[model samples]
Target: ATLPGEQLFEQFTKGLELVFGDKPSLGFICGIKEAVREDGATLPGLCCIDAPYQLDEDYWGSEYQCEVDDGLGSLIPNPCERISPYFGKISEESCKVYGGTYCPLTDCTRLQECVAELIDIARNENRTAFANYLLNAPNITDPENSFQCGWAREYFGFPANFINDNQICEDIKQFRNSRDFEFLEEFFNQGSSSDEPGDDDDNFNVVPPLVLVPPDPENRDATEAVSKKAEVQNGQAWRATNFALESAAKTLNSIYDAIKDSKCPCGGPFCVAGDICKLVQNIAQKITVVGLILIETSAEISKFTYGEVAELGNVEPIQTGERVKAIYDNMVLTGNYLQRRFQGVNDYLERMENRLVRALAPPSAPGPAPETVASPSNPNITFVVRNGVGCDGLDQDGDSVEDNCEEDRFPPSLRLTSKASTSFVCEVDYCLEERFRTQTEAITFLNAVFDVVDDCSAPEFVQKVIEQIPGTVCEKTRFEIIPVQTFPENSTCADVTLPGISAIVELGLDTSAPTVLCGFQVDRSDDDRRVSPDSKTLVIPSERKSSFVDTLLFQTTADNCPGPLRRMVTVQSNEFVYGTNSVVLINQENTEDGSVVPRLFVNPQSCADGSQDDATICDPDPVSDFRFYEVKISVTDAVGNEAVDTCRVIVEPSRRRNLAKQTKDSQRSSSESGKGSKKIIPIEELLLKVAESNVRYTLATVTSEVSPSPVA
Candidate 1:
């Protein structure tokens, strides 16, 4: 930045002096030079010393014209049309790092200052004085001897990377590279160049200052406290373990003293074996004591200060810490030793017990098994399993193992079978049974229908009937209408767990970006166990089997399910109900990428039974005895606020065949002669009461004056 009347001519000349090392070098920039007289027309100075100095030399203007008159036009003509040839004649000592000096060393910084000062001088003060000197400037004796320079373009922040290999750009790069100036370090450390394509004017990308927090005062002793507590636990655990081992050893010795003298059946030579056999029973009892000790010791350790920690309170902290570590190492060894010893003693006892039990037990008898003919009508066609009845210690039923330790031949499994009457393979069982009411005198027998859904994720609508008895009902039931919920309860932001239904929002796919799929957590009461959000086992049955959007895989987020509980469950995002009136389970899992991905428990398995290799998810030929499912549940809160509710779910006829609707249709049809529910209506029952009163009056009249009292 130049200013008015700042002596710009001498300043830029001084920059040339430093670059060329005090030598009288030719001007590197055409635009700035002291003017002088021409060769043929000299005044006082050799070229143009008496003329005013100029800061800007327009190649097309009088300054260049004067240069031509002075016979310097051949060397410095029209710099815009062709850069000054002096650009290719940079001094060997100039700063040369690359093709251009966009941000050169401090030497170039000072030169730029000089050039900038003259720019202002040309505009505000002594403009003509500078202009006169610029024209008719003396030509250099050797154009190749001009000082190399680039400060003007770099200081002005013009792009130095011209995208071409021009001579001026090449000269600037070489001049800057030739220097090893430490003063240029600041420019190199800058994050970006001013001429970069996307650099912002404000340079907002500069590094921010760091912040640090002072350590907490309490934290100074926190590590020592934790270490001390762990030491106390170790000491307590060691002492308890030792006591258990000592007690076991004492009991074994006492038993050995008693058993060695009495057992003498093999006194000839193998009597020692008899004595060892006698010790087997006592050893088994001692092993049980060791197992009990392990459980009790672990339970004691969890009792806070009352347990092992209390026992270690009097010990010195340093000594206790070292002893704790030593005891911990020894505990592992002791545990392994006792376990191996127990196994040996238990094995010997088992062999002796097996021999004695087998000798006393009678010959084994096999029980009769019910025969099955593989009839589809038989609900119990599947095999039944029961534990075998054999001598307690010996192997039975030809398997090479003790009966008590026999391995079950079969695992618990399910098989889908078909019914005989309907050749269609049964995927689900639906049964209804009728019963006449006997206990209730006021109510008549009616078929009560109960429609129910088992899964809560996507509920199937069911219609149920209650007897409507004139008494206090014992049960209350409520099914949540909305399972996938996302709503705040108050002015403050709340966890996404609203009881009301969730508002539906439009969903779109962003295939341009990939994301993890996840869903929201269900609102369960605090006591209710939460199924892992990661391995979401819930299902929302849908009518169509389509993509994620179509499959209804959207829910609000929940915080309880974090870490491993929050997982990325990926599978088919389609819901395949396929239009059968059966259960629908759309297993959608919450994934990490904030997307809902559907997971399948059974894939390539059709809901339709008997489809080839189809693993059906329903019971075949299941006998569900339809009775009124009545249960009473009492809910008592912490404050003893109690509520008792009894719910009775029974099957009811469809709405079209409802009792009230049937009665209405019957009454309407009666005007044209027709039928309906024979159950007594209020109006008909009243009319029948009046008719019976009249009949009683007539009978009284036939019996003479005995009918005098009006049948009220």
Candidate 2:
């Protein structure tokens, strides 16, 4: 017979295959077995054995009844009777030995009770044991069983079961070595021991060893070494790759530099090395062939050419190719190319080399020639002036001699004549007699004479002579005289005249012929005399008039008059005199001697004294100078030329010492008469009284005339 534990274990294994598949790991499968074992009694329990065969009614008595007992007494039977009853019955002695003296039925009842109690104990103990087992279980490694039976999988749906077998064990080992697991185990064990009922030292009980595993030092060392080697290998690979790239770049740079620096026989540095070398070789071959040809041709040309035409005038022939090549070689070595053509090289180099050769070579010499000097061979004709004569002199007729015969005459003559043979004589008296080839020469001679005597200073006679010479004189030749005149003192007059007087006096001018006098007067004065009060001469105070003269003189020239001739005249009166009985006419021309014949006459009867006095008094001429005698003279020329002249005489007061004296007796008589004349009124008072009397008489006359006739 199978034990319940074993049967349940089998059932769980089968269920796991159906639910989770595969044989689970031992730890998790064990946990599942324990859970099932604890709950085994609760799952509807199965019978241990099948039921017995049922009895048929044919084999039983017709009246047989199926009675059943409520307890084990009915299920068990008595076996003491020896009557050979049915095969199912047992004797009483057999019942006592097999079931006990209580009978089979009672024994059977007791056995059933014991089995139920054992089942109850097994379930309760298994549940507690299963929980403990799972808490302490090792990690499961099987995928299916771990997923189906682990606490996390069972309660939640965590697929801890999905962890690979090796990884699960690794984690489990890591957890076991952790301090947390160790602490948990120690703490739980101590608590379990403390809960023991009768143990005094249980609190101090030693905890079981926790299953914490220590790390494997050998594996750790192996892992570190492997990781370090991998990192170093990777670094080395990167460095090697970078170095390879750098080397490649350097190689490329060198190639570029070589190409850039290389010179090509062609124009530029664009060709590769192989191309440049080929070009150089080909050029050399061509140059060699050209040099040979040039040399042969040059020899032939030299044989035929010679002299100046070949050397200078003609273009020189270029040598053939071979000769040119030979020259190029020689020039490359010694640098000379006088007779060669340049080709197959750098263009600039060819040009430069040619220029150098030309510069270094000597120049060619010139051919021969002739020389002479030039001069003139004829003498120029010249003319000379005789006397004042020149080429322009007049001859009146076509004859060359001047017509007029004066002692200082300029004899006309002709030296050079024009080829036209036309001759004419100058008719002018002062003409130049010498002939001139050019008018400019004649003009130059005349200008010299003009410089000596210009028109403004030349004499008028000389100007007239020049003007009357027909066309012989230059129009610009004329004479002018500037008169500078000064007038005589007191000779100027305005409204009066004197015999033998001219309006304008000629000075330093030609008076041999009549001429008009015209010019402005400067600094003129009308007074006859100028007085300096500081001098002893008495000044006659009077208003006088005078003017400048611009006049014409008939039949006379300015030379007849003296230098600084008087052009005007003035008349003036003497100063006032005082205390004279009568004004006298002294000499008007000589005031100091008073001896001139009087030109003025006045009757003394016309004066207040009615006396014929010869002197004037200040009382008679108080308004001005006391010249009482005035003479007015009328002049008539012998040819009926008429004019007037006036003279004045002044008589001044007598000195006080020259007065008549009175006698002493006469003075006494006059004093007495003055005393007796008190009754007589003074003349001024008598005049006043007479004026008042006249005024009253006139008033009475006016009143009577104005009033009505009294009682007519």
Candidate 3:
């Protein structure tokens, strides 16, 4: 008549009893339920038991057919197999209702592998924090070799024993005498009861309490009696403190495990954002709970015999006050370690949040606009200079007011262009005169001022503009713009000499960046061509007696009249080498003379065997029909102004002219003439010129002779 769910719960309880032969504490039962919930398992609910039940796989093989390889050669029960029996009858539909699904065992294996990797990463991070902070070790310059930073055995690799081993920032002698460490060591110790101090009559029992192991039915009552007597002798307050310490130790272990489990186990280049968010939430919640438990336990421990209330007690504390202080300090240090871990999680979450915001931000909502705005009437106009008063001459519009007279309603527009060859000049005087003599004059004045300053409305220029006119305000000035003759580079005009009051003004300074000139020698043939007159494009034949040499000329010009220049060239292909002996050197000499134009010598092949050097040999035939190399040239002037230009060098495949035969024939002819054979010197030696030399040399001709008859 009982319900099926109730039957399952009854069976589960009976199984526990059969193993331990006694009713377990309510906390122990609840602990199991909590573990099941944390593991994310669900099953048919009974009021007493919400956790799912696993079928006896050994007895019921057909119902739980699914098995996974344990990474070893052995197969083990998979989650699907383990959860199948909770449904009473296994079915894909029923299993999926509780979030279970049948999948290849390999999928489960991969998940486990990923989890193992995350656990390893978590352990490494924890080791680093422990080494750097808790141990008070030197800063880790290299994280990969930081193991030596802490106690050698405490953070030793694998099967972590950090919490189990001795670890405190201070000296071991001091730590051993500390009260906080006494409780910690005793709580986590795995040794049997014999290792503890003797428990005889008249002796106070300070040993940490252990869960009672179920004895034989005949001895059960007696075992409980002894445990009860011991608790009474110790005093209930002392017993409560010990229990709290025990709970605290367990909680610490849980925290360590939680850190390992909280990491997302996706083993791909990127994980799902939702999964990462879930991982962040899970870790934060776990840490929060663990922190609360430690705080509560420490509070409980502080209220003990040797704690704050020790003076109020009738009996003196069994332990010393130093022990309490030690416990408190150790708790603080534990919190420090936990805080380090929390900070890592916090940083990772912040980075993820920033990335999410950037990726999800709306594209239509652009950032704020810049300060400057172009005139509505003419986009080219950079500024509009307005005068409070305007108007000049007799009326041409046939109105009561003179045509070019009376206050003008609007300001004149200023346009800057790159067309002018001379500096612009502007005149500023009060009145119904004119803002500009002509529109072209306004444009030229704008060009000059703009070249000197980026913004006319800037703070530095505002005062300068006000002082330019004699007793004339910026708003009242007329003939605002005029043309001025160009001065030498770096020169500025001073002191306004207009027929007016004294006004000091400075104008016309060159600050613009220099320009670089790049050119290449042109070649014309079936294998080479100059499609355009510009130096930007050129074709050259690869076939040559020794190596092909191409001259790349460079020049740099700055506004401050040409000065000493530094030139650098970079070829964007493996087919070319530059400078002396394949080493590019920057010019070090200081000279303004134009005769020494900075030149870059490029040799496609510098050896007779068509090699760039002794180490690299090029194929007698080109690798491809045509290869294009981009040559980038940069130049810097004495004033630090820099410019860069690029040109394309196209290389045609070699034509195989049989130069060896020609050389042999030439050598024979020279010998027959009784001139003797000329030694075949490498052409690269002739082409490789000293970089500092003033003179230049070119290989215009190459001749060799071949003998027709043997020289007996």
Candidate 4:
């Protein structure tokens, strides 16, 4: 019913499905067959089985004998003649040409032999049982068994080669190249050898009528030797695989250990293990430095007393020396830590290299030697030294040895003295042969030296000496008293003006001994005059006077002076006192109000005594003989002590004129009385009219009588 090609296609599709689990689509099966054909291979053949309809023993016996004779006669000329006669005969011509008898009977005989051997192999715990079963049953083409053959063919492509070889023994050599042979070889190597046949065996007594002899012993022994060699090679391969796996694991562990011990390049506190620790420390250090600078600068600006004169700019609050020190400390810590971490990383890297070398090389070969690693002990991280100022006392030759450690040398001791005035002297004991780069720098260095001393000194003596120095030292050397002013119980100059009050401080440079003074001067005006009479004159030692004067002149005030009185003081001889030449001048002409009345004045005539050329204005007594006629009154409140009132006496001539007119009108009315009922205007009304009339007259006289036209 079907064409040869069509029938072949159908049989191939059915056979593939039975062997490989499921039937693919017709097109897919056709494609697979086409692919096989393209590669010079043929699809597997399929066969069907049908049961015998009826069996007559006598008849079957005769027919079977005839078939056996027919098959034997057909195989008589074949090279495998020894086993051919065992096949039952079929049509003589069909058997001879197509060998149907040998094809079917040989396959059945092989299956029986394989099954028996497999049972024996299994009972003996032989791993080669499965391999031997496949080998012996090579012609069993039942679909179930064929499916396993197909699986092995697809997996290793060996059974396909065996089939292509037309079942020849030579094909086994080609099939052995497949990966399946490796499994087969491993299985066979682990199996026990087959037992030798004995004369006592009953199976040997009943021989088949047609028997097939086994292969030659020489060929069998050669095959067995090849199998043994493969087994030995497989064991060596497994050992190599294990060695590679272990070496890789060791290398990975070494790398992990190195990373764990390695330090971070950016340093602070080692917080590598904790999350974001390095970032937090970095931010904290930056904030601390910035906060210190801001606080110090604010303190310096608060020293000014007067609201007007203190408005001068360039008064910074931070102590430059302290700021530099803070920066230096942070940098040192960071740099030192980084150096250490770098060393550790380098060491780790070397160890990692060694591990890699060992992994790649043989165990007997020596590994490359590890390199020596080093870390910096002290990385001198310092601030930018400006013009020989704020040197950290480490410059030996005054050459600004900020970058190099070789040039660094300790500075000499600085001595400071506070006098009765509000200014102090800072003296350097070092040789003057090493000249300062600039006068400003010299002043700054000296002031900083004093500040360092003051910061570490006793609290009682700190304020007395610190208050002597004016605020205007160098920008980098100014020391500010925090919170503007503080009142400690044991202060010596509590009642004195703000300019005279000293602040006690420690420079924080050293903990061993007091080395310098950080003096603060209250008065900033050029016209230096003592605010208090009881204040004493301040003096500096002749040698250190220049440093004291320079620092005093540069310090500025926060607010300008409000009233005529200017507070002035100086520090000298370890004391804070009022300045000698300070003057309080009134500048009310520049006030917002147009009034020219002098708010404050010192009468030269009143103050003059026969003793001194300069007149002294002492505290005035309200009940004194001094006249208050021209003096304008200024009232100040107690709380802020700020001026709250301004009072001036004004004599009105218009009121006098109105009074005269009212008197004249009252007299005239009295004389005209009794004759007519007098019109009596109330005294208040009369006074109002007279006042209005006088004002109008005054305006007219000024406009028309004094100047015919308004003055340009």
Q: lDDT tens digits, residues 374-436, model 1? A: 211212121112211111221222233322212122112111123212223322232112111
Predicted candidate 3 versus true structure: per-residue lDDT over 160-188, tens digit per residue? 11111111111222323333233333332
| Tens digit per residue, CA lDDT, model 4, 1-712 | 0011222222223222112112111122233334333322222321111112122333322212212223445522112211111101111322342222232212223323444454465335433423343343434455334454444333222222123212222223322333333333333342224335432211111111111122235566554444444432233333332333233233334443433332222111221112122222233233333333432332232111111112211122222333332222222212222233324434544644444233223223464532222223222222221111112112222233321333212112224434112223333222121123234444444454443222111233233223313442211223332211222354333333122222332221111111111122325232222111211111111121111122221111121212221222221111111222211223233346432222221111111111112333332222221111111122221112222121111111223334434554666776677332324223244233323321110000000000011112
Off by over 4 Å in 2: 1-380, 384-626, 629-648, 652-712
Best by TM-score: 3
- Best lDDT goes to which candidate? 3
- How well does candidate 3 match the true structure in TM-score terms? 0.20
lDDT of 1: 0.25
Report the Cα lDDT for candidate 3: 0.33
Note the Cα lDDT for every prediction shown. Answer: 0.25, 0.25, 0.33, 0.26
Q: How far is candidate 1 from the true structure (C-alpha RMSD, Å)?
A: 46.5
User: Which sequence of candidate numbers ranks them by TM-score, best first?
Assistant: 3, 4, 2, 1
RMSD in angstroms between candidate 3 and the native structure over all alpha carbons: 33.8
- Residues 1-712, candidate 2, lDDT per residue (tens digit)? 1011122123223232112212122222233323233332111111111112112334232221223343666532322212110101122332222222221111112222322343354244332221222343333343223233343332211123222222223333333333332323333243334445553321223333222122235555554444444432123322332333233233323322332333322111222222323332233333233333433333333222211111211222232333322221121211111111112122323332333222212222122211111212112211111121111122212122321222112222112223222214423213233333233443443333332221111122122111111222221121221221121243232222112111111111121211222111212242322122221121122211111121111110122222221111122222222343222222233457432222222222212222323354423322322222222333221112223332222222221111111233345566887632112212233223323321110000000001011111
Ranking by lDDT: 3, 4, 1, 2
How good is model 4 by TM-score? 0.15
